[model samples]
Target: MHALFKHLRQVRDGGQRREYSRYLAQRMGPMIHALMLVGALAYLVAVIAGTLVRHSPLPLWLRLAPLPLLLLIAASTRRVRQPGLLSTLTLLCVALLEIGINLNGADDLHRQSVVLPGLLLPVASSVIWLGRWDFIAAMLLCALGPLPMLLSGNIDSALVFQYLVYMAIAIVLSTVLRAFMARTLFEQFRLERQLREQANTDGLTGLLVRNRFLELARSALAELHRQRQPACMLFVDADRFKQLNDQYGHAAGDAALVALAATLRRQTRAGDLIGRIGGEEFAMLLPGNSLEQGCRRAEQLRLSMHEIRRPDGPLTTSIGVACSQRCRDDIQTLLARADQAMRQAKNTGRDRVVCSPDDC
Candidate 1:
């Protein structure tokens, strides 16, 4: 039961919901068209047969009156790309068929409304309805659609019971099928997300790589510019990282890098972007942060580096902070200023924070 709930939980995420719905709409367009075609044809055949073979007393034209309306609805189904809209149109089609069947039977109360479209529709439609609510709606309509006609005909209680039981079984089978498909699509979406993240992030630290960081940072900065908000960039370097690697080993160096990445991740906001720009070098882009705030953040981050333990010494990093308002608007210029300040920090002392000099 928990697993079933988990499978259905994919739509809980706003992004996943949008993605799944769009995918569902694209896949369901042709399917909806097919279902509409089938429904229209079946209704047409049932109407004609009732008039000719069953001796339905209603005028053939009155009995077949809904055909044009049905065809119009079917034509509209060709381009519908919204799930809710598609469901509404489908339910409309189903209801039209049910009404048509009811009209066919109005001539004689003994006519079986429980047959034809009602018997087959709910179960048949179970496969195409991607949403649980949509499926339930269709099922209820199919199950109860023929009740008035059936009861008016002096139908046996046993037969109604049999129909209800068959409906229950069909619903269960369709529900299982829906659950299976949701699980499959959800898994596919998750795998695709993982692949995309892997491609964009560093293998060891899981921070954005240099190229991905630059690509996203430019967009973030553009938004900041539009908002007229100050932005800050930080260039962080492990002090004496080469010496530590030489003394400790590449494995130890890798561990230190991972630890630094984790610390950066813990300290930053979700909107802040961190990237492993180079070996022993990382960068952060803080949108809407002023120079003072960036400096303070850098100092706090430098102090936090005091916690990560090592054999010879605690981990220490030199962080350079540069504000967009102080530097040129270009990211490259911001990066260069931040890099210069970082070098200044490294030169003045090993582990410290430095804010870039104003470019303006």
Candidate 2:
């Protein structure tokens, strides 16, 4: 049983470093399932071995007598699905099995020897599956399992007692070790998740970075095409940004960018993809929006920007709107058209909205 518990921890730790919770769950979930299956299979094999040894001439049945109890313990574990509960139950079942084996075989020397190792199984189960209290429960059972041998003189009383005491120490030590390993694995998982978030997010706008933004946009584009769904993109560039940076310091320029990014975040819907793709340039991908709807949204953003009072007084944006079905399958091509329209808006005058001619 100690060996079985060790096997479980080995499998669980093997996949705990995955970066995403979804991927981590998917990876470890299978290994845990496989561990349970293997434990169950081992129990069945023990039962078969017990049955075959029952007819042996040398009384191997007594040596393998606790095998049925171990089988019962393994079978009980499969019934509980929740991790903490299952672990506790597995430990309790093993402890109870040890008590039963000890009581029934008080006078059989070989049976007593087999039951001593059975005591270790409970300790292992408690360390691997259950919490501290469960570990103590199994440890107490370990103490009890050997006392019958000491009482009946089936084994040297002092030697059996000494071995029992050593097993108790081992159980406590194993439980502590297991807990440390579990904590380390969880910490690694958290760090990996944080690293992934840092990689996929932009520092300036706190929005999805360019690569992640494009990946999401491409998927949304594919879905829109399949459903013939309405969708729009608003390509926004801060008007006179280079002049602003030159006249005011770059510090003031950064402040303006931050302010605009905050405004865009507040203005966009929860499902919209608002991303910073380049200096003073951002884009919004809005699903379920047509050209007319996009025009209204872009106008709202334009008015909002004009209303903002920065340290440099105010700043404005030039926006170009492009809706789905206005162009071919390429996202870059669609964005290029939107950029051209934005350039047109800038040429006509800044702080204005322009849409594709098909939209007009």
The local distance difference test score of each candidate is: 0.82, 0.66
Encode model 2's per-residue lDDT on 1-360: one tens digit a residue.
354244334335434422233333333444444444554455446545554545433344554555566565556544444555554555555555555445444535555444445545544444243234555665666666556645664556566656666776767666666666545545566677679779988876687887888888888887887887777888999998998889978988888888899889889886688878789888888887888898899999988997666556678999998887644445676677778889899999888999976542
**Tens-digit lDDT string for candidate 1 (1-360):** 458648666468787787777777777779878888887888888887666666766788888888888899889989988888888888887777777877787766544545645567776777787677878887777777777776775776876677677777877877777777667766876788789899999999999999999999988888888778889999999988888889989999999999999999999996999999999999999998889899999999999998987657999999898889743477877887899899999999969999986555
Q: What's each prediction's clash count? A: 0, 0
Worst 10 residues of 2 by lDDT: 17-26
Lowest lDDT 10-mer window, candidate 1?
A: 109-118
Q: After superposition, how far is residue 246 of candidate 1 from its true place, in Å?
A: 1.6
In model 1, which regions exceed 4 Å deviation?
A: 1-6, 9-108, 152-159, 325-333, 357-360
Q: Which sections of candidate 2 miss by over 4 Å? A: 1-21, 55-182, 325-328
